[model samples]
Target: MRATVIHAPGDIRVEDAPEPKIVNPTDAIIRTVATCVCGSDLWPYRGLEPVGDPHPMGHEYVGIVEEVGSEVSNVKPGQFVVGSFATSDNTCANCRKGWQSSCLNREFMSTCQAEYVRIPNAHGTLVATDEHPSDELVPSLLAVSDVMGTGWYAALAAEVKPGSTAVVVGDGAVGLCGVIAAKELGAERIIAMSRHESRQKLALEFGATDIVSERGEDGIARIKDLTGGIGADSVLECVGTSQSMSQALHSARPGGNVGFVGVPHEVAVDGQELFFSQVGLRGGPAPVRRYLPDLIDRVLSGHINPGKVFDLTLPLEQVAEGYKAMDERRAIKTLLTP
Candidate 1:
């Protein structure tokens, strides 16, 4: 087996690795069929995040279960599954409250960028549907593993409602999914703030009612114009930057809510500014596992294809090329196959 390893900044390689084996009663092992490079992965690659030691690099995947432990019941050895970025024991207090990311005994999720991975707490962390689609739907299924989940979280946190005007910040995969999420929640007007033509097209396809091509005050002006001088009813922040965060804040009307799901690189908010506004702020590391079941059903039923965000594909050995394309802003997202 081979896994993607990041030895240092601007460095990535495929190294021979041993096949993962189930070591606990609740554990399961899966062979990776499809995986993807996320915007978060670029932080380490671009030296924006620390790289203290060589580490495995991926957190999204969809594959077939090669083996399962004795205690695993819901999922079997031969089933196809989609897993969250966090591994949790579904029986725990937090898991039952729709917050599996904070499960009492949750295990830190490892990158699934390899050919094989050992999934702990398999019964609680993995979900199996009827029939797994062929290679064509693999990318879409894998999207539910992370970005799509995070986007859905953003919509929920923002308190979106039908006939409500919504604004989305950032044009990444997660932001685009936020568009789909807002639509699913019945937002009457979806305003996608995107400068890139490519992502703007996808945003519209996902149900954005309008597109704003400006930044700073100008972007906010466009959003206000669309809403007839009032701001949006809700705003979803998908970029973890001060500028993007500020734009989201300025685009929401009084008493509106903001759902920020970006990784929060170095965000700072002005207390005085927020104090005078009626907008509410809330968001954090997404509880992706919370929505996996509903999302998987939608995918399996063909209600959505969030996986269309992947604009580039590469073989496992050429995984480095996939990273380069994304880091250089040449591709929206990259999908890798084993």
Candidate 2:
């Protein structure tokens, strides 16, 4: 099998690697049908996030089960499934509380950008569809595995409500999906901060009622101006940078909330600023498994199409190009087919 390996920052290659197999009775092996690059992955690619050693890359995936361990009874061979980037035993305490991303037995699903990959805790980590999904539904279903789920978590954490103004910071795939989630959650006003025309257009299509192209304090002022100086009721911070995080915090009203889902880099928050702002803050890795079922249903029913985030699609062998396209911001997200 061939998989993506990042030897170092700016060093990525798709090369031959050992195939995966059932190592645990709770595991299952799946042949990947589709996978994609994530913004978080860029942390290592850019040297901001260290790679201790050359290892497998990619976490988001959707594929057909080829085999399952003896303990995995809920899913079977030949079933199409979507899974979270983090594998978890659904029976854990955290999982029971709908925080599967922090499950007691959690593990990162790495090196999935290959022909086949092993899924741990298959029964709890993987969600099987009612039936095999068609090719047209694959991309959207694929988004449920990570980006869309994270976006949904942002909306939920921010407590978006009917008739409330929800501001989304960042226009990446997850941010755009946040717009979709906010709309579906009944937010009357959706403001997306994006300078890119392509992303702004998609944000509107996903239910954004306004677009703010400013940055930093100016962006915060724009959000305040739009909300009559009260700021928005909810703000979704999709970019983990210090600038974006501050903007998100300032964009919300004193009693409002900000949900940050971006993979934090060199970011530090000021205690005094947060204390004075009086805005609630909450966000971490999304408990994708908790939201997978509903998101899957939405995709299966064709009620939403979050998969439109993938502006570039390429063969798995061309995973290098996929990364390049995203790294250069030439594509919002890149989908890979194996």
Candidate 3:
């Protein structure tokens, strides 16, 4: 089998790798169909995270199950399934409480950007759709594995509710989807901060009511203006930078909620500021498995299409170019087919 591997910073290659097999009673082996480059993956590419020797490259996909372990009763052979980026045993205490990403007994679904992948706790981690979807539905269904779920979590964490103002800081794919989630949750006003026309358009299509082509204080001011001098009721911080986080906190009204989904790196909150502002902060690595079922159902029913995030597509062998495109900011997200 061939897999995408990052040998070092800026060095991505397609290399030969051994085929995967079911190693646990709850495991399943699946042949990869579609996968993509993720924003988080860029950390290692940019020398932020230590790029281990010849590490596998992705954590999202939709594929055909090749085999299932003896204990895997829910997923079966030949079923088309979508899985969470992080796998978990559904029976665990954390999982039962809807925190599968932090399950006490957890195993991550091996990198998906390869010809084959080993998914542990298959029965609990993978969701099988009614039928094999059309080629077009594949991309959207693929999103249920990660970004879409994370975006939904962003809105949920922010406490977005009916008739509330929801401001999203960041114009990335997850931030755009957070706009959709906020609207679906009944937010009356959805403000997306973006200057890029392409991303701004997608945000609008996803249910953004207004666009703020400002950053820093200008962006926060726009949000405040939209909210009639008061800050928004809910703010979703989708970028994992201190600038974005501060903007998120300032964009929300006092006593409002701030949900951050970006992978924080050396970020800290000022105790006095938070105390004086009276805004609530909540967020962490998204427990995507918790929303996998409902999200998959919505995609299967054609109610939402999150695949719009992937603006470019490439073959598995050309994955090196995919990473370059994303790292260079030339693509919003790149979808790769194996």
Please write out the lDDT profile of model 1 over residues 1-338, one tens digit for every residue: 89999999889999998888888999989988888899989999999999889988888888899989999987887788999888888889988998888888887666688998888888898988678677777887899988899889999889899989999999999999999999999999999999899999999999998999899999988888898797988999999999999999999998999999997888999899987777899887677777888998888788988999999999888889999999988999999998
> Tens-digit lDDT track for model 3 on 305-333?
99999999999999999999989889989
Cα deviation at 54, candidate 1, in Å, is: 0.7
Tell me model 2's lDDT, rounded to 2 decimals: 0.93
Better of 2 and 3 by TM-score: 2
Q: Pick the candidate with the highest TM-score.
A: 2
Off by over 4 Å in 3: none
lDDT of model number 3 = 0.89
Cα miss at 236, model 3 (Å)? 1.1
Ranking by TM-score: 2, 3, 1
Report lDDT per candidate: 0.89, 0.93, 0.89
> Candidate 1: deviation at residue 311, Å?
0.9
Worst 10 residues of 1 by lDDT: 103-112
Off by over 4 Å in 2: none
* Model 1, TM vs. native: 0.97
Off by more than 4 A, model 1: none
What lDDT score is found at residue 64 in candidate 1?
Answer: 91
